[model samples]
Target: MDHEKVNILLVDDQPAKLLAYEVILKDLGENLVIASSGREALEVLLKTEIAVILVDVCMPELDGFELAAMIREHPRFQKTAMIFISAIQVSDIDRLRGYEMGAVDYVPVPVVPEVLRAKIKVFSELYRKTRELERLNQELEDRVRARTAELENSTAKLRESEQRRSMAIAAGKMGSWDWDWITGDWMWDEGQYRIFGVSPESFEVNPANVQALLHPDDVDQLRKAIAEFNSGTRAYETEFRIVRPDGEVRWCVGTAAATIDANGRVVRVSGVTVDITERKRAEERQNLLAREVDHRAKNALALAQSIVRLTRADEVKAYVNAVEGRINALARVHTILSLSSWQGAELSKLIDEELAPYSLGGQIRLAGPEVQLLPATAQTLALALHELFTNSAKYGALSTRSGRLMIAWQAENDRLTLTWEESGGPLVRTPKSRGFGTRSLLASVESQLGGQAQFDWRAEGLLCRLEVPLTRKTAASPAPGKFDAAAAAELQRASG
Candidate 1:
C-alpha cells in the first residue's frame, strides 16, 4: 500500500489486445505491464506492486480465473484488485466463480475504453490515498516517539535540579515556606519546623499560631511588616525574634514575595528564612565595644588637654616635660585599670606607679591596705601624686640625700585619710605665692577627686594631709582646656 509506484497487469494471448488495453489506460499515468501468458503476469506481479490486474478470461495455458486464484493465494497480493476482461459471453456460473476468486469487476470484451479507464482511475486514486495514509501514519508514529524521549529527558533534568537545590538548602539550614493568603493556608518545609523548634505534624502554621510563637517585643513590628506586604507597599524582607517552644528567643531573617492573580490580587506568598541569632548577638557585642572605646578615647583626650593647660614652665621644653610626665602617670594607672576591664584600679598599685620615677630606697616609704579606686578617681589621684613627688624632688624632703619621706593611708568611718610627712631636710616656710604645680595639685584633688588637700610648712620639712570619702562620687568627664594666649600668660605668671 506504501509502494513508490503502482502497477496494472494486462495478461492476454493476443499482442493486439494487450496494445489496445495499454492505449486505453495510458492516460491514467500508471505503469501497465502486458503479458502474453499467465506466467509472464506472475513475473510482473512478483517484481512490482500492481494496483489493478486486467486479464483475458481465454488466455492460453492459464485463464483469467486461474491467474486470479493464484494471485489471491499469495498473501502479499491479498488486497490487490482484479478485473476480468473477455470477448466471450460469460455465464452466471463463471461470473460467480470469478467473484469468489476476488474479482472486483467483470468487463465484457469490446470493453468501452471510457469504462475501462474509469475503473482503473478509481483503483489508482484508492492506491494513492492508501499509500499517503500509510506515510502520514508513519510520520505520526515517529513524532510521538521523539516527543516521548524529549519529555523523559526533561523530567530527568528537573529531578536532578531539585536534588541539588534540596542539598544546598539542607546544608545552609535554610527553611522554605508558602502561604495562601486568601485561605490562610500555610506550608512549612522540614527545616522550618526545626528552626521554630516544633514538630511539623502538630504545629499549626496559620498567622495567629505563628504570631503566638514570636517574641512579645517583636510581634508589633512583624505585624506592621506583614500589613505593608499585604497592602502591596513593600516586599517581605524582614528580621525579627521568635520565642521557640523551649523558651529560647532566636533571631530570624526572611524574605517573601506575593504571587499576583489575573485580577491583580495577591493569591500567595512564599519565601525562605534563616536563623541569625548568633550573628545578632555578635553584632550587639561589637556595638557595645565600639561605644566603650569611643567613650574611653574621648575621656583620655580630654584628660590630656586638662593636664597640658594646667602645666607651666619658663620654657616651652619645660612645659612639655611637665605635661608629658603627668600624662604618663595617668597612662600607668590606665594600664593597671585595663587589666580589670576598666572597672577600677588598686590604690596601692596607683601609688607605686606615680612614685616609680623618684623612689629612694629608704627615704620613700608607703603603707596602706590594697583598696580599689574607680577609674576616673584613680586617674585624678595619679596626677596629684605626680605633682607632689615632683615638688618634693625639687624643694621638699627628697631635695637632700639625707632627707626621708613617709606616706601612709587608712580607712575609717567610711572615709580615707592620707598623711605625707618629711624629716631630716631643710626647714620649710610658707611660700609667698603658689606656683602652677601647687595650684594644679589643689585643683585636681578638690575638683577631680572630690577631696581636700592641705600643706603645712613645718620647721623640719613639709607635711601634707588629704581627706576624701572612701567611695567618692565618680567625677564627671572634664571639659577640654583651651591653651589660648591669655591662658598661656596666666600659666607663665603662675610658673614664675
Candidate 2:
C-alpha cells in the first residue's frame, strides 16, 4: 500500500557517509534532509517537521547524544525518533545512554546500506499509518457533531409543533394567547377576550397590561413564573388570579414556553389560558370529603390495632395484663379525634387518655409546646407511644408508686421532635432480644414519619426520642387563591 511521505534528517560530519545514506534510501520514497554537522542538523530541524533523525555519534562540536538531548527538550520535536551511527565499537553503557537520550536504534558505521534503508522504510510506514488514523478520527468526530446538532434541531421543531397543536385544541374550548417576545406583540384568540369579559379592541395584549389584570397577590407568582422560563431555569406553569373587566376576580391557569435564538436569547413565549373557577370549587369540596373519610378510617384502624394488642397480651400471659389495658385507653383518644374530623388532636388530651389506665392518681407529667398532630401521623404515633407507655407501666417507671413519666413535643423548621423520659422506676437494661413492640416503634418512626427514632435503655430509665417531618401534618391548610386552568394550559404551551 502507498504510504504518506516521511521527512528524514540525516546528520553526519562526513560528506561521503551522508551521500551513501541518501543514495541507499532514495528508493524508499521519503523526503530526506541532509546536514553535515550537529549545528546544521539542529538548524534544519528548527525549520522542518522531520519524523526521524539519523545522527553520527562521533562529531567534533556536538555528538549524536547531545543533539538527541536537545531535540528531546523541544516539545514540538519530543516524539521524533533518533538513530545513532558510529564507527567506534559502541559500549553497552554508551548504547544505553543513547537509547535513554531517545535514540530508537543504533547502526554501526562502515554501514550496511540496505539494512539502513530497510529500518528507515519501517519507521516511515508506521508514521504514515499514524497520520492516516488521526485524520480519520477527526473526520468521524466532525460527522458525529453534525449529526447531534441535526437531531437537536429536529427534536425542538417537533416539540414546537406539538405545543401549537395543544394550543389549537385549547383555543377550541377556551381562550388562548401567543406572545412574540422579539416584537413585544401578543395575539389573543376570540375566546381569550370573551373569557376576560373584555372587548378585544379595548386591550393591547402585552405582558405589562396582563400584569395589570392580575390580582395583586398573584402578580409576584406570575412574575416569578415568567422569570424562570426566560432564564431557562424551568418551564412555566403558574396559577394566578386575574380580575375580569366586570371587576370580578377569577382563577386562570397560565402555561408558557420560551423560544430561544441561535445565541440562546429568549425570543418568544407561546401558550394557552383556561378558566377553572368551577373546577377549583369542586376540588375544594372533594378535599374536604377526603379529609373526613381519612379521619374515620384512622379511627377504625386504631380500634383494630387496640384489639390486636390486647389479644397478643394473652399470648404472653406471664407478663403483666396492664400492657393490653393501656393500649385500649390510647385507642379511645384516637376514636374521639376521629369523630371530630381529625383537623388535629390536642396534645394534652392525647396524653391524658393514654395515661388514664396506668394512673396512680395522675402521676405522669406532660410538658412542652402544645401542638396538634395530623390524623395519619397522630394515629401511628399514638400506637407507638401506647406501646412505650405499656412497657413502662409493666417493667419500668410507671410500674412503681415512686415512678414518673414525662412526655414532651416540640416543632421547629418543619420537623417535630418528641421525647419520652421516665424516672424513679425499676433499673433498665438493653433487652437480649427485640420484641414486636420494639420493631413496631422503629418502623413507625422511620417509615411513616420519615424520621429517626432512638431508644436508650439506660440505668436511670427507658428513654425514647422521635423526630418526624411536619409537612405531612399541615398539607390540608388552605393557601391564598391563585390561577386555575386556562392560564395553566397557556403557560404549558408557551414553555413547551
Candidate 3:
C-alpha cells in the first residue's frame, strides 16, 4: 500500500522556510516537493499531484492566494487542500479570501510544527483513498480487447420420401435408416450396412440390435435427439460414436426427423448418418491451437502487468502516460510476431519498428548483421529499445539539433552485443538516484534475457551496450531463422 503514498507540495520564497517545512513533514513519510516561488509551485502542481499545498502567503511574482485561485479554476485541483503559512498578523478578510480560494487551513509562522503535520496527514489520507476507489471501479469495468468465435451453422435436410422426414443431405452416399411404429419393423440402406460393417444376410436389422451397437456413452445423445424430434421439432442433427461388429469405434453425424399424423401423433422416424471421424480429429487439432494462442497472449499480458507495477511517476497522469507508452511498445512486438506466425521475427525488423517514430534527420545511424530472434527474445528486447529511444528523445542525442545517435550490433558465438552511442547532446552527468527507466532498462536486458547492460556517462554524451544470450538449441525454440514441427506446441511451451 506504500505505493499509494501521496505528494505534499511546500511553496515558499525563502530557502530556510522551505527547509523548516521539510523538517516538520519529513516524519510523515509522504513525498515532499518544494518550490521556491508561486510560479515554480504551479509548475510542480501541473506535473505532480499534491495532496496538500503548504504555501507562503507573501511571495514574489505570485502570492499564495492568487496561486490557489488559479489552481481551483482547474477541475483536477478543485478540491486539493491548500494551507497558507503567513508570518504577519492575519485579519478576518484575509482569512475569507484564503477560504474562498480552496484553503483548507492556515498556519501562523514561527508555526506550530505539530498542527501543520496533522493537517497534511488528514488530506493525504483522503486523497489516497479517493484514488484507490477510482482505480477499483475502473478495474471492475475493464473491457477485454477482442474475442473471436468459430460458428458452425446447422441446417436440417428436407424430407423427400413419403414418410415426410427431413434432412440436409451430404454429398456422398449417406447411410440411411427408417422405423415404423405401427408395423414394428425397421429397414436400412446398403450404405447403412457398409457403415456398420455388417450384411443383412448375416445380421438382422432391429431397433434393439441398433441400440446395442451404439457407443455406451453416446446412447443418451441418440435418445435425446429422437426425443427432441418427437417433441414437434421437424428435424434434429447430432454427432455420436458407434461400435461396429469388427469392434471399431467410429464417429458419426446422424440427422433425423419424426413423421407426424394429422392428429399430431408421431408414427414413423427416418434419418441419415455420415462418417465424420476425420472431421472430429480436425476439430481436436484446432482446439489445441486455440489453447496455444491463449497461453502466448497471457505471457504478453503478464509483461504489461509488470510494467504497470514497476513504473514510477510523479503524478497520476504521468504514470498513466508511461504505462501506455510501454504497453504500446510491447503490443508492437506482438504484432510483429503475429505477422511471422509466432515462429520468430527478424532482429532488424524489431529495430526498424522501434525507430519508425523518430526521423533520422541525418542524426541517427544503425549498423547490424541480419539476425532473427525467437518469439520470447524479440518481446523483451523491444521494450528495452523503446525505453532507450524514449529517454534519448527526452534528454539525450535526439533532444538536441546538433546531437547524433548510432546503434550497432553483432552476433558472435551464442551471444549478441548491441551498442548505442550518443554525441553532441548536453553534457552528461550521472544521476544520484536510479529511476524506473534505468531500472527497467537493466531488468529487460539483464534479468529477462540473461544479458549484460553497461552504461558509460562520458562528459560529452551517453553510451549503452547490451549483451543478450541467443535462444537455446532446442526443438521447441530452434536456432535463429529456423522453425520446425508444429509451431503451436513450441509456442505453448514457450508461453509456459
Candidate 4:
C-alpha cells in the first residue's frame, strides 16, 4: 500500500473537459492523471495505483464503459473507484450499464466540483485504511510464524526430557501415582500396575481398587496415614502390606505429598511406591528366630526346675542319675523336634525313644495310629513314659522273660488316649502308697499336661491309662494353640 497522495485518473477525448476536471479536483490535494482517450487511461492505470477514475462517456475506440470494464477485469484494479462524465444525457440502460461496469457515479454536462471532490475524498480515505489494515495483518502473520518456530523447539526438548524420565522410572522398577483429593480417582503409571500385580488395560484405576490390594491388617494403618496427611500433620510416608491377586502378600513403602491450592486446600496427592517384600521377609525371619531362641531358653529353664523339684532319690548318686536320665530323654525329643524346626514332635517317635532298650525284646509290643503332639506335650509325655519303662523293668512286666508289655494310643478331637498293659509277670497287687516313680509319672501327666492319669493293679499285671490333649493349650490353662497344618497333613497321610 502506497502512502503517497492518491492518484485520480481523469479521461476525456477533449482536452478542455480534461482541464476542467483537473482544475476542479486540484484543491482536493490528490494527483490527477489525464488521458485523452480510453486507451490512454488504461496506460496511466498501469503506471500508478489509482484511487478513483473520472472519464468521459463518449470516446472513439474505447468509451468510458469499455475503459471501466477493462479496468475492472484486472485483479489489481478491481477495487479502483470509477465515475462517468458525459455532455449528452444517458439513457437508463446506459446508466445501468455504467454501473454494471463498476462505476461509482454518473454526472452529465458540467460537473459540480464540490460533489466530485467529496466523492474522491471519500474513496481515497477508504483505500488508505484498507492498505493500513493489510499492513497490520501481514505484521501479525510474521509474529505468528516466529512464535510457532519457538514453540516447536520447546516442544521437542520437552518430549526428549520426558522420554529420559520414563526410562529412569522403568529401570528402577518404581511406581508413581496421582490421586484426586476430592473424587478419590486414581491415575497410575505402568509400574504401579505392575507392582499391584494387575494389568493396566484390564483393571479400572480407582481408590477402591487400590484398597482391594491392601492387606487386611494394613488397611487401618493406611487410613490413619491418609487422615494425617489430610490434616497436614504429616507428609505421607509409610510401609504397608498388599495382598496380590495371586494370594502373595508383599510389603511396600510409599511416600507422597499433597498438592495445595492458593486457598490452602488440598488439590491432589501424588506419590511413589516401591516393593520391599524381600527386605520385609528377611526382617520377619530375623524376628521369628529371636522369638524361637527366647522360647527355647524359657522351656529349658522350666524343664530343669521341674526335674530338680520333682526328683526324689535316697542318695546323691541316684539323684544325679535320675536327673541325667530325664535330661537325656528331653535331649532325644529335641533331636526329633530339630528335624521339624521344633514345630512339634511325633508321638510315635517319643514312645520309641523311651522304649528303645526294650524294643528288640519279644516282651514289648507297640501299636498305635500316627499322631503328632506339640513340643511341650511331647516333652512331658516322654518323661512319663520313661517313669513307666523304669517301673515295668523293676517290678511290672519286663522283669520276666515270659512277661510282655502292650502300648496303644488313639486320638479324637482334642484328646489323646494311651494305654499301657502288662501281662505274664509276677502277680501284682494294689499298692498302699505311691513311690517316687509313680508320683513323677502322675505329676507329668496330671499336673504338667493337665490330663488324667490312672493305675490298676491286677493279679497278672499293672495297667496304666493316660488321657491328654494333643495340643499345647492343655498345659497350665486352655488357650488357642498354633495348630500345625503340616502335622495334620501327616496324620491324614498316615490314616490314608
Provide the TM-score for each candidate, comma-separated: 0.52, 0.37, 0.42, 0.50
Writing each residue's lDDT as its tens digit, candidate 4 over 1-496 gives: 4356878888989988888888888987788888899887888889888888888888999988888899999999998888888789889999899999999888777678888788878888887778888889999998898899889988988998888777877776679999898888889998888888999888898767878989988899878978887787536788998898999888889998888888787878999988888787899998987877666666666566666666778899988988888788878888888888878888998998888977656788888899988877887788789888878887878888889899999999879999999999888989887876677667667756778999989888989999998764644222222222222232233223
What's the ranking of the predictions by TM-score, best on top? Answer: 1, 4, 3, 2
Residue 129, candidate 1: how far off, in angstroms? 48
Candidate 1 — which residues are off by over 4 angstroms?
A: 1-205, 213-235, 242-251, 257-295, 315-317, 411-415, 470-472, 476-496
Q: How many times do residue backbones clash in model 4?
A: 0
Q: Which lDDT tens digits does candidate 2 get at residues 143-188?
A: 9989999999999999999787667656544676777877889999
TM-score of 2: 0.37
Pairs in steric clash, model 4: none
What are the lDDT scores of the predictions, listed in order? 0.81, 0.75, 0.80, 0.81
TM-score of 1: 0.52
lDDT of residue 431 for candidate 4:
88
lDDT pick, better of 1 and 3 = 1
Per-residue C-alpha lDDT of model 1 across residues 1-496, encoded as one tens digit per residue:
3445578888888999989999989987778888899999999889888888888888878888999999999998988988899788989998999999999998997889999999988987897888799889999999998999999999999999988877777777678999998998999998888888999778888888899999898889867877886777536788888899889988999888888888778888888988888888999989977876676776777667656866668898888888888788878988998999888888898888887777866789999887777777777677778888888888888888889999999878767788889888877889998877787667666655668989998989888898776576635333323222222343344455
